[model samples]
Structures are given as structure tokens and as C-alpha cells.
Target: MTVRSEPVLVWDGAIRLVHWLMVLLVPLLWWTAEEGHMDWHRRLGLAMFGLVLFRLLWGLFGSWTARFAPMVRRIGALPSHLARLRQRDSTPSFGHSPLAVLSVFALLLALATQVTTGLFSVDVDGLESGPLAIMVSFETGRQFAEVHEFNFNLLAVLILLHVAAIAIYRFVLRQKLVKPMVTGRRPRADFAGADLPDNRARPAAMIATAIFSLACVWALGNFG
Candidate 1:
């Protein structure tokens, strides 16, 4: 039996911050939007939109493990990993499993689309239309507005499923899936064998994230 001794900081602090930030912001955004707390809800929506744009850029050019190419794997791998779970056997995990990677990408894409569309959406009472609502024709903006609302409901379902899956992994499978996300380190017992990616230096990830975040803000200010 081989024992893995060394622990690696697989997720950089920025990555962890963005991860939990979304977790906190999602529910707040949902409830406030539904309850007609438009002022705070709109503020939170804009914040989340900016954060998602930042994350998209980070996923493209940030740390080794953070890149979508490495994090999102082939779909077939998901079923195989789940089968291993059924047998009570250990599965190889470095960053995210294939299904989780897909879920993250899907959620990000959906959020980006929904947020951008909502910016131009108008309510039935003619009270509010997004700041950029005038950019597009009224008819097209209305369609996008409807899509935005539908996407929000879809995102909620996905989030609930994600939370349930994490719970199963924690209690049923006896794995600390959430712990690694919180601490950025996995306990030795969490896996049978762990083969992780080569961690890039922290300075590099931070530099890339900062540059990308600034560029998004600049563009939004100038053209938004």
C-alpha cells in the first residue's frame, strides 16, 4: 500500500475566492430578484456579471489547473468514475472530475448569457429596462429578456443538484469534497491515489487574474 504524504495547494486563493463568492451571491441574487428587491438585486447581478467575466478570462489564461482545457475532460470519464464509486473503489482525481468540470463550464456560460441579456430586459409595467436595452431593437430585447428569466430558473435547479451531489460525496462516499474547496488542501484519506497537476507559482496566477479583471472593467466602463 502506497501512502501519499505531501499535500498540494491545488486551487489558488483567487480561484477559491471566486468559487465561494459565487456560492454566496447566487442565492442572494435569486431571492432578491424574485422578491422585487430590484435595487440590491440589480446591483448584485451586475457584480456577478463582472465576476463571471473575470472568471471566464481567468479560466482561459490563469493557472495550470484552472484552465478549462485541463479542468474539463471527456464526457465518458464521468460514467467510468461513477462506476468506480458504485464498487467502493478509489478513483483518480487531480482537479475536477469530468462531470463536475462540465457542470462548472455550463453554469458559467449560462450565467454570462443570462446576465448580459438581463441588462437589456424590460418588465411588463415599463418600469425598468437594462442600461443597454436601447442598444438592441425592442422585439429582440424582449426575447432575450424572457430567455434570461428562464435561464435563471434553470441555474437554480443545477445549483441544487450540485449541492446534493457534494452531500452524497461527503456522507455516503465518506469523502471530503467540500473541505478541499474550503481549505485548498485534501486530507490523505480523501483519496486512494492522488495524481495532481503541476502547480504554477502563485505570483503568476495572481498577475494573470489581475490583468484580466482590469481589462474587463475597463471595457465595461468604456462600452457598457
Candidate 2:
């Protein structure tokens, strides 16, 4: 007879919400930009910025599975992790694998760069400008506009790579990477006796963090 292990919570609701929201909003942002809907594009950019900020704060103050410390520590063992991967040793990580943490950080930084540049960007005709474009010289704003366009392409590449990685893990490695992000839970057998955290920040905390992020972005756009 085969014994089944109980399911364990691996991702928090807030983390899953933010992840899926980004999945939707990213394409919306791209489509809006392509359609010349600058108003919707700018609004989407602000929402993405706020979401990134909320994720950063959540990484620090939310759930253990979502935190940065374990992810960073795992980075030092990346060599061995790769070795195990080559050997097909399917050791389950309670959170992101070491290499995944690097990708996550890179995506965050890239998104931040995109949003910051967009804030100072202006179109060639000067008809459409970011809220904070007025703070910079026309020449500087134009330069930033160029950078903003470039950064979107970079973000697209990163996202494609991310999706490819997920596919590789799902098929080659026989790992289900998307399920936990959607359901916030994974079979206990996947962890292989790993000590996982049970504490997750309340929904109220996520709401508060999101509000704080939007306020910060609003203040920056208005005052600076």
C-alpha cells in the first residue's frame, strides 16, 4: 500500500495574488502601449510599480517561504544544487530554488528600472509625458523615454526565460512549478522532510503594504 503525505502550504495568498496579477497586468501593459493608449499604459505601469514594491516589502515582512534570507543562503549552495540537478536528485525545496532566487531578484530590479525610467519619459512629440517628466529637462526626459522602451524589451526577455524555465522544470524535471503559485499548497512529499514555515501574514497585512506602496509612488510623482 502506498502512503500519501498531507499537503503543506508553500505559498501565501498574497504572494499568489501578486504573482497572478503580474501575469495578467504585464500583457495588458504591453498591449496598451502597442495600441497607443498612453493613459492606460501609464496607469498599468504605476500598478506594476506598486505591486513590485508590495512584493519587496512582503519578502521582508510576510511569510517565511516568501522571505529573502533562505533564498540568499541557498545561493551559496548553488553549485551543489546544480550537481544534484544533473544527477536527477529531485530534492524538493520548500520555497524557490537557489537559481530561481537570482531570477526573481533580477526580474524585480528590471521592473524597477523600467518603472523609474518611465516616470521621467516623454514622447518625441512631447504630447504624452510621464507624470514626473516635468521634473527633468526635455532632453533628459527624451533619453529616459528611450530607456523606458528598451527596458520593456528586456523585461519581455526575462519573462520568456522565466516561462521556459517553468516548462523545463515541469517536463524535464517532473516538477510542477505553477501549481503551488496557484493553490498556495504542495504535497508534503515534495518537501522531503524539509522544515517549512507555517506562519503567513494576514490578508490585512498585504492590503496595508499595498496601500503603502501606492502612497509612496503617489508622493514621488507629486512631490518629486
Candidate 3:
């Protein structure tokens, strides 16, 4: 007779909300750009920026599972982790695997770069400009605009790679990655020998952080 283990919570609500919001808003950003809707594009960018800020803060002061310390500490063992994966060792991690942590860092860096460049970008006509365009020369703003365009393409590539990785993990490796993000829970058997901690944070703290992040973004969008 086989014994089934209970499900364990792996993700917090804030993490799920940010992850799904990014999923929706990123495509929306591309669509708005294609339609030449700069106003809406800017608004979407601000929203994304706020979300990113919230994530950065959450990674520091939120749940233990969401903190960057564990991820950073595990970086040294990434090669070993990859080796184990190659050997078909199915040692499951309760939080992000080392490889997934690298991808997360890469995505965050790419989006932050895109957002910063966009703030100083100028249009071809020089009529429409980013909020910070006035702080720089036309040539500088134009350069930022070029970089902004290139960074978006890079971001798209990263996003595609992310999706491909998820598919590979799900189909090829027979792992369930997406369900945990959506449901915040996974079968306890999957992490049987792993050190799983209760890493939930207060909902009120998450709300306060999100509101503060949005306020900062609003101030930046208006005054930067």
C-alpha cells in the first residue's frame, strides 16, 4: 500500500499576484506599443515598475521563501545542482531551484533596465518624450530610446526562454512548476527530504508594501 503525503504551501499570495500580473501586463505593453498607444504604454510601464518595486521589497522583507538570501547562498552549488539534474536526480526544492533563481534574477534585471531606459527615451519626432527626457540632451534621450527598443526585444527573448523552460520542466522533466505558482501548494512527497519552512507573511504587510510601491511609481512618473 502506498501512503500519500499532504500538500504543502510553497508560494505566498503576493508572489502569485505579481507573477500573474506580469504575465498579463507584459503582453499588454507589447500590444500597446504596436498600436502606437504611448499613453497607455506609459501607464502600463508605470504599473509594471510598481510591481517590480514591490517584488524587490518583498524579496527582502517578506516571506522567507521569497527572500533573496537563500537564492544567493545557493548560487555556489548551482553547478552541482545542474550535474544532479543531468544525472536524473529528482531532489525537489521547496522554493526556487538554483537555475530558476538565476532566471528570476535575469528577468528582474532586464525589466529594470528596460524601465530605466524608457524614462529618458524620446520619440523619432521628438514630440513625445519620456518624463525624464527634459533632464538629458536630445542626443542622449535618443540613445536611451534606441536602448529602450533593443531592451524590449531582449526582454521578449527572456520571456520566451522562461516559457520554454517551464514547458521543458513540465513535459520533459515531468515536473509541475506552473501549478505551484497558481495554487501555492505542492505535494509533500515532492519535497520529502527537503527543508520546507512555513514562510508566510502578513497580508497587511504585503498590502502596505504594494501601496508604498505604487506611490513611489506615481511620484516618479509625475516628477522624474
Clashing pairs in 2: none
Can you tell me which runs of candidate 2 are displaced by over 4 Å?
217-224
The prediction achieving the highest lDDT against the true structure is 3
Task: For model 1, name the residue pairs that clash.
Answer: none
Q: In candidate 3, residue 195 scores what lDDT? A: 69
lDDT of 3 by residue, 114-167 (tens): 888888889889987878889999999999999999999999999999999889
**What is the TM-score (0 to 1) of candidate 2?**
0.93
- Model 3 TM-score is 0.94
Could you tell me which residue pairs clash in candidate 3? none
The C-alpha stretches of model 3 lying farther than 4 A from their native spots are 1-3
- lDDT tens digits, residues 3-43, model 2? 98898888898888989989999899889989999999988
Q: Please identify which of the two predictions, 1 or 2, would achieve the higher lDDT against the true structure.
A: 2
Whole-model lDDT, candidate 3?
0.87
lDDT of each: 0.75, 0.86, 0.87
Off by over 4 Å in 1: 1-4, 74-76, 90-92, 188-195, 218-224
